[model samples]
Target: MAGCGFDDLPLTRPGPPLNAWGLYGEGDEYGRLNLITAQTVQAGLREAKEGITINLNLPLDTMPLNPTRAPLRHEIIHRTHCNDDHVSFNTQGSTQWDGFRHYPYLNYPEKQQYIYYGGMTSDEARDRSNHRCGIQNYAKKPISGRAHLLDIASFLERHQRSPLSYFDASTPIDLETLESCAAESRVVFKPGDILIVRTGWTEAFFGISEEERQSLPHRQKRGSCGVSSDPEVLRWHWENGIAAVASDAVAYEAYPSVNSPSIHETFLAGWGMPIGELFDLRELAAECKRLKRWTFFFTSMPLYVNGGIASPPNAQAVL
Candidate 1:
């Protein structure tokens, strides 16, 4: 069939790829749901063989204070915990999806695309009972695929430099900067792979003096980086066909939008791809850099809470 009268057919064709990214596919345009099992997911973790679990557990202790811009008071009910026993569980914080509901696109400042598949509405998407892109999808089974870690820290280190020791509130991640980092790291990216960035910014804030750290421009806004976000950089990530993105930086992207626009529009709203903000990728990045290898058995399991807006994943980078 390949050589036979294929030339007779029109040059143009309309169809999805053998492995397309969106909700549907070619043969089964309305893709079938893949039920991930606990055993299968465990197998993925075992394949990683690192025996290391990067705790993506949300700092419940700090969460309550985050809303008030102060430390959490012990008197307040700890929503994420159940009991005082260290091992004894009392009550657990109701994990959320941090759905498109969690953030707004700074640039367009509009709602994420309301995609309805199989007669579902955008409002319904948030309904946990409906299971529309619930966090469960992230953990019902292991996410098995190619993963690439872009070591922003190593990239700068190779050039005898580094990102600021602290969030500068002025640092911005642009396309050129990302490309330059990739070139230095000698990393070649592939489509549909998870893209991870290592900024090393979160580390600086962890133990810094509250006054100096809080005074930083980005922190003054939201305890984020000093650099602003850029649209072109996001366009690059989307154009490259990245399935998802994770960053070591606290805010994933920059803090304040220099151009008054953020890439969240392009990646989250426009593409419907998820973002793993506040990922702890230091060791992972360091390991890849030292090994001079990138491909790995990557997996992350997000909490399976219904109607959840965000999830604290058990994200892992295994080689």
Candidate 2:
């Protein structure tokens, strides 16, 4: 395939896989790396003036799953006597992000890496007590920034096109349709900006009966379909210097891709991007449409566990 000029194809080769944070791409011409040393909670707090800060967290129990696939557990002791004078009921669970010690790819740790600064394993990393970027990373951060919402569902609705009752789990995304949605929205992106997308899938999940949701598999091998994002769009985000990308879908990239899930591979492995998935953008989308402003403060706190693989972001938008 390299002989076919395929070497230049971004997704053709194996790169780093997605971690708890996001993809980290290859080095650049000037030896610069993708998504290296992003702004941490300390940095964010230094910039905030103050206003009404809205929380984007949807209580863990309210979240679709009991616990994300991340490695962690909680023990509940119904009856436990600490000393008889006081009976102590104990419950233990890992809150926020999964440390690098939580997961090891190819049996390796993220020691000296971005999130994992000191060591790799939990023991080596000092019992995973570090909170470098943990939920605290978002503390004191300003929720006041330029935010834009791309409502793909409304774009489809205007054309009288409706997503499948249960989006075709096997269909590849239509790139053209995605471009059309952007055009219809009259949205413009700037460098170092935050981007948000709405697909209305989150609502569908909520609307379904509990029994129905329980009956469905966690994720289907054949994925959902719609205007899937193309490489050019992904490149646009990078070239335009987009700081972050948020989506209300299960996975940001379109399912059943024609290009081998290039978005995930590139963003996670190649660029070290920070993705906000399973975000609650409905309120923000509605406000953007109502005001026709399409801009606001986009903020989120990712799990800051060192060497962690993934974390549920406490995302929010302040308009």
Candidate 3:
């Protein structure tokens, strides 16, 4: 762990493709978040110009079961004077972030190592004293940094001849297209910056009728536009020193992940990286368009649900 530079990270890939298990340390729970240092916070502070804060959280009930994972159930408890509402929902029900415990490094054939990120044994994940990764770590010390929004949907609509679909889960948002959008937005990419991408999946889902939306089957094998599930994209994430990358889609990467695994497996399971999903970027994106800027001071606060796998990101962007 001593004298380990960023270049010397991972030491060696315990799992194939690329694994940053030992990059932070044998006991590291917060992976790339370690990059969000004082410098990054200062950089974020510099971007807060208008003091206009855009709420990135979508309504909890909006497509609560879009990913078809779990439906949110609620009940009301009426007291003598006041009534209390009880809500039961999955961490990913709505606008939320995926914790390290949510997925595992399952590409490998080894049963023990494939159980979770960093090749962690099952016991390590459930052990007491919280030795393994926990979402509360981020809750305690939230990730504050310069946020760059790569509004993919907005850009696609401008160039493509035909109307862009809500999402092309089957199609990977190729790097060329991604960079073009950034160039168009004139947003500078920086290390430790949090990138929020919008593919218009959430907007498309909410645009439907309530009855029609509810009638749709769960977990449908449909496509959503996201970062290309390619090796180069992963390389870009690591080389750029990104703290985390989020999207307005269900999964940050293309559904079915094109060919190779995307950030879902490698980021959360391999590198212990975190990801935000299903944020409301309509207002933020509109503001960016008016101001001619895509960068902001981004902040997210998670609930301190100890040992919880995921939580709703009370996220916002200040510009």
Q: Work out the TM-score per prediction.
A: 0.64, 0.61, 0.90
Measured by TM-score, the strongest candidate is 3
- Residue 18 of model 1, lDDT score: 16
Candidates' lDDT values, in order? Answer: 0.49, 0.46, 0.77
Q: By TM-score, is 1 or 2 better?
A: 1
Off by over 4 Å in 3: 1-10, 66-68, 110-113, 123-131, 161-164, 167-169
Error of 2 at 295 (Å): 1.7
Q: Can you tell me which runs of candidate 2 are displaced by over 4 Å?
A: 1-55, 63-145, 164-173, 218-222, 226-229, 256-258
lDDT of 1 by residue, 226-310 (tens): 2235545654664564656677565566754455335443344333456666665667766776677655656666666654556
Question: How many residue-pair clashes does candidate 2 contain?
Answer: 23
RMSD of each: 8.2, 8.7, 2.7
Compute the lDDT for candidate 3: 0.77
lDDT of 1 at 186: 66
Of candidates 2 and 1, the better by lDDT: 1
